[model samples]
Target: MLKIFKKYYGYQWLAAFMLGLVLPFIGKLLSVSGLHKVIWFYLIINGLYTLYLGYSVRKRGLSPLILFALPAVFSGISTLLLHLVSHQYGFYFGLMYIVLSLFTFFGDTRDDPDENQIPVENGFRDLKSETKNDGQVSVDGNLKV
Candidate 1:
């Protein structure tokens, strides 16, 4: 489980959202009972998380595609703020969440370790070794004869 979490931990919000979607009536109940404050707090946390996600993705050098996460961060903020006052902006938040989810689902954010692998045997293999003729010139004019 820890391994899976490390691999796909960024998708935790999606899992939470799915669970919330399945149990929306509880959220509605909380909202009606003046407990939206708690929900607002959670939304703030979500906002921070979305912001972190955006920044982390951008820091990972996944730019251009990383731009997609920015709106999600802003929308997470917008949702928290708007949910504090009214529910009219819920649709916008939903749209932004969908966008974030799509980005999370499809974006290739993983860095390839192979891309950074250094060759064990580069061309400069014998730089310290003295050649047979240090001052001799070759046909290609390589040495200082």
Candidate 2:
């Protein structure tokens, strides 16, 4: 399970995203205002972390990180600002964050040739000739009889 988790960033992002999604519901169920605030804080922090991730990937020439990260950061900031301005736009900002995060999380940045320069599997096999005289295994894994 750890190996599987380590295989993709999407898994980590998904976990964070799900927590953000369920926290509000859980708060409502328990009638806890503190829990709701905590969830919102988590969402903001995660948004920042995701923005950092985009910058790192972009540094590696994976893709245009700004294209994705900008919107995500904007959405997060908007959410916070909505509290000061009006709660009417808060939901819209939250939706934008969700959409941007999902898109960036599942995006094909790693698939870019610039990012994945190493050839995973080359079809060409190493060629070597072996001569055998006695019953033994050769250096190249060839049997000599």
Candidate 3:
């Protein structure tokens, strides 16, 4: 699994780089600034997030730090390259991106107990469960259909 992820991880990098390349072009077209520019950047960042998220769901990939970090760096450079935002604005933009992406990624993930697994106090015991779709969970960890 690690090998598979290592092989495909480049895809995440490539997407971020491509996003950087494309964003300046899109900015040129829309000429967005002020609140709109922030919204635009946010949307783009989250769009990249979905790419990282897809891989994560399969348990076949690693962190979104690639998506978060690369795009922030590239977007900062892009502001320099394309003169999209002033230096001060660009700085804040990059900082916001890093903070927001990290928060977004970490905030959304969870390590809760599996809904299908029942809690056991003792060592082990035989148990059976049936469900009829009543949206309730029995003590032995079975769905009510």
lDDT of 2 at 56: 48
**Model 3: residues with Cα > 4 Å off, grouped in runs:** 1-8, 29-38, 41-61, 80-84, 108-122, 125-145
Q: Where does candidate 1 stray beyond 4 Å?
A: 10-26, 32-43, 60-88, 95-141
Clash numbers, per candidate: 0, 0, 2
Model 2 C-alpha lDDT versus the unseen true structure: 0.48
The most accurate candidate by lDDT is 3
Candidate 1: RMSD over Cα atoms? 9.4
In model 3, pairs of residues that clash are: 133-144, 133-145
Worst 10 residues of 3 by lDDT: 52-61
Report the lDDT of model 2 for residue 28.
Answer: 47
lDDT of 3 by residue, 4-73 (tens): 7567676666655655546655765787665665566545564456544544533433555564644564
lDDT of 1 by residue, 57-134 (tens): 444544434333434433443345433323454455445544554554445545544556557676556466557765
> What is the Å distance of residue 65 in model 1 from its true position?
8.0
Error of 1 at 61 (Å): 6.4
C-alpha lDDT values of all predictions: 0.46, 0.48, 0.57
All candidates: TM-score: 0.35, 0.32, 0.50
lDDT of 3 at 31: 74
